[model samples]
Target: MSKIESIDAKAVKTYARTEQTVSDVRSYRLARVIEQLKISNCPAILLYDPVNIRYATDTSNMQIWTVRNPSRYVMVFADGTVISWELHSCEHVWDGVDLDLELRSAVSWIFFSAGHEVESRCATWGAEIVNVMRDRVPGESRLAVDRLDPMGTSYLASKGITLLDGQAMMEMARLIKSPEEIVLMNESLRAAEKGIERMRREMRSGITEQELWANLHYENIKHGGEWIETRLLASGDRTNPWMHECSSRVLQKGDLLAFDTDMIGPNGYCSDISRTWTVDETKPTDEQRRLYSTAFEQVHFNMDLLRPGMSFSEYSEKSWKIPDLYLKNRYSCIAHGIGMVDEYPSISHQVDWTTAGYDGVFRSGMTLCVESYIGAEGGTQGVKLEQQVVLTDDGCVPLTSTEFEMDWL
Candidate 1:
């Protein structure tokens, strides 16, 4: 049986590196979206960010964009199927992936920013895209968008574009794993593990936090890592601050060094992990040991609580207070779902559930990172643990093999 139940891990590994074609991926993905929407006719999607662009068009070409200025807006349809135009005149038009010329020419409008083609140029491109989508898609045709700024939403409303919250639809689409996506995510997990191990080995006395970050990044890159989302390395006082911002402080004896990083794999999927270490030459202090154990317990506790059909807030409240009750340490909530960013859905609190924007039930095929940290001494050196897990029918499966333990070198 494969480690991942739904798909064959080995077979996925074989096709993982065929050099994905953006057009093919986009075409397939758009088909999937169309099927999900149950729309018989074709509908156009306007993409702006690289992430959304990658999701929609399957092309990572940065040039496919349009701007709105001087009361006239342009839309880059990329395909008549959506009825928009392709924006021309991007900074790196040459860098576009080799796509069909006909497909490129099908782009409709190329509205320029205020002054680019003419003086002082400023453009709210997303608003223009929404407006165009509203104008083109018939009132009966359901239009979907990933996210829209308030201004963009208002413009869509004015243009009569029926806004079907894109996040909800896209979240459903992204939550379930495709064969290709799973393999890429697995590759990202492997790279993160390698980076973690390298950091463990290099965590020694006298090492600067910046140096540790550099070492980890180098290792991740050396092992086919594609791009780093964040390079955070903090020590001592910084660690206790929960979301401790990374600094240039040097590690020393008794310093608890905490590092958190997330990166995109070769396939453009995301991998996020965090760990903390103490630089003591000998045994750690009593306080340090206590804090570490508290964090470890919570990390495992949250993992055990994860499953299908459970409410994120219900489970979160149940487990979030563990630190305060058991360890007598008060801190922010630990653990959250992980995907393309530092924090995401599939894991959230009751407040999040009721507070709007992020309340949802835990389901199979979602990925999350169970995280916990314990601070000491008015907010200084703290112990932390973070592990990535995927929701399964039975329970959850961890992506990385190594346990959350500090390497006191």
Candidate 2:
């Protein structure tokens, strides 16, 4: 079993967006940010999260690396003025992108880059940011910020800057999608489905979980995806508890392999789909069949409950009622908004609504994921299933084309 059969990845075709479509989406995203900024009465927004930066300006640098190291950032004024501080002289990354922004050299302030000069570096960074605040926001000291460390916050505060909740503002802005965004999202989901298909074709006894997971990564990148957010692939006994990441354990016949593809695909949009399949495509035991059927029921049941204008609480109340035996191991969220990443309004389960729930309306053009995890507290194996969809005035329409294992049941 050491020598696995060779597998070829299927070619993934995505929509070829025209220059006009790209320009339209960029303008729409910027307008949404400006609308949020004006609504919050903040003159500008300070973006550190690469995803948010990409939303504001269609430029992507070191996304995962920049998360830990704030190497780049952007400031979007309520008037739609964009000041982007790129890493060093790498401003050329935005060369042909249909966007207009004042590019400047980023002042690297993290200790890994600046070392002992972090304090002085903060002085340099704070000065530039302060100038923007003063110039763009006259008679206004408030600026929305998605993320910033205490040192940066203190320095900016010392310079008469007031920070608002930019994450909340941005979430509200990105909650609803524009027409052009949906086209790009279709392309992302298409690439993700191709990756899932490759994973399915390569699924077999003796294949390590890690090895199988790499196929997904390979297909994603080969087909224009950006990156996967996690390695949530587990097999057999590991599947019951859920949230277990993929590892080196080899697959065996009749084992259940569950995974959540939280992929950042083409155009930085996410295609968060989850599924559970049997290793070697073997006939599952009765218990495995039961587990998968229950999870499948939960996913679609909740998905059918979604509609535009429904409140989160109402949705939670009407969501699938997880049986008492599996309540403890249920997926944390019944549904959540999805866009460039998992965006606003996480709809909670009925029992968990009190603490984790908030109020929000389901709006047209909002993408969401219906999640399920079915397993008793000490069960031998579990099943996890999820579906990504677009919420419209009539109902929800699924985005992922990856098939479920209905025959196994």
Candidate 3:
């Protein structure tokens, strides 16, 4: 076995910014959306989803907050014109930033102050969208919306505008990443690696799992990361049965600490990497070695099986089989597409695919996260391993370069 090479955060960050213009990446993404709209025969898109808004406008302010608040949104026309709406005075969030889109304050005073005329607010927004469509799309135009409140949907239907599933269109557009998007993802991965390095250095027995988790957050934010997607960190017995979020549980000497960094870093790309580390300076037990080694092998084995032009169904059928004993606690999917985070086209194990999977072909430029978790139903501990990679013309290239903990093996 060869030594795994790790990424140099500073170098990657420097190269990402210098090698590509952020505006160009934004344009590339928007162009993809436009292409998808044409294919779907939709003339325009009403993007209320913050992720889709960021994808179209290349700007975000209070993304997580806006997820439920409905304070901001964007509209993209088939001709590639973008109209961005922000809450009153919130438009200043992008004060000095350079962007290529029209900006406006969303009409939401009624909904915000009175809190009763939700339909009125939706009507006003729908009217504004109709006006854009009439001016930009000409005759018999249809509008696509990724998601909308019921009132908004009703308002659009009353206005006689056809609504298509904009979410599906956006997903199709985002399936294959552009070169610049890949660059931004690499930057995100490096930033995540920096966070992992901090966590590893601060790992020690007696420290609370939450305390160790903070180290990763500190490093990520210090380097301009946006937000962590989840708090799935656990130690010792908490590692089994999975999905255990970070708690105040103190680490023991021989405990295994497993974490999944479901984070959105620079440029809003996700860097999802999982690792299980031993807390003490002492060696892992024989059983610990077996679990970790099995997980590590499973992750790499599936990663190796990835290639361009493979049908999802075919891949699912041919992928490695989990031993029957470990199948009960196995992860939902052998791998999943990663872009903004767990995007699309999940490749489940053969035994699990019929009920849990979807079919699509793997194309060059698609980014994927290969996942593995090894633990028995009543096991005391488990190992979680994942690798992020980009599908190339002939094979896949790893985006995450952090070395697995060789000591555990």
Q: Which model scores highest in TM-score?
A: 2
TM-score of each: 0.74, 0.95, 0.93
Report the number of backbone clashes for model 1. Answer: 15
Question: 1-409 in candidate 3: lDDT tens per residue?
Answer: 1111122323333444643467777677888999998898888888988888888777787889888777787888778877878877877766654555688888753455438876666677779888877887778558889978777777778888888999989988888876667778888888899999989899999899999999888877887889998999999999998999999999999898899999899888999999988897558889989998899889877878888778999888888788877889998898898998678878878887778878889887788899999998898898899888877764667787788988766
lDDT of 1 at 41: 39
Off by over 4 Å in 3: 1-16, 93-100, 109-114
lDDT-best of 1 and 2: 2
The prediction achieving the highest lDDT against the true structure is 2
Candidate 2 TM-score, true structure as reference: 0.95
Among all windows of 10 consecutive residues in model 3, the one with the lowest summed lDDT is 1-10
Order by TM-score, highest first: 2, 3, 1
Given candidate 3, what's the lDDT at residue 287? 90
Poorest lDDT segment (10 consecutive residues) of candidate 1: 66-75
lDDT of each: 0.57, 0.86, 0.82
lDDT value, candidate 1, whole model: 0.57
lDDT pick, better of 1 and 3 = 3
Superposition error at 224 for model 2 (Å): 1.4
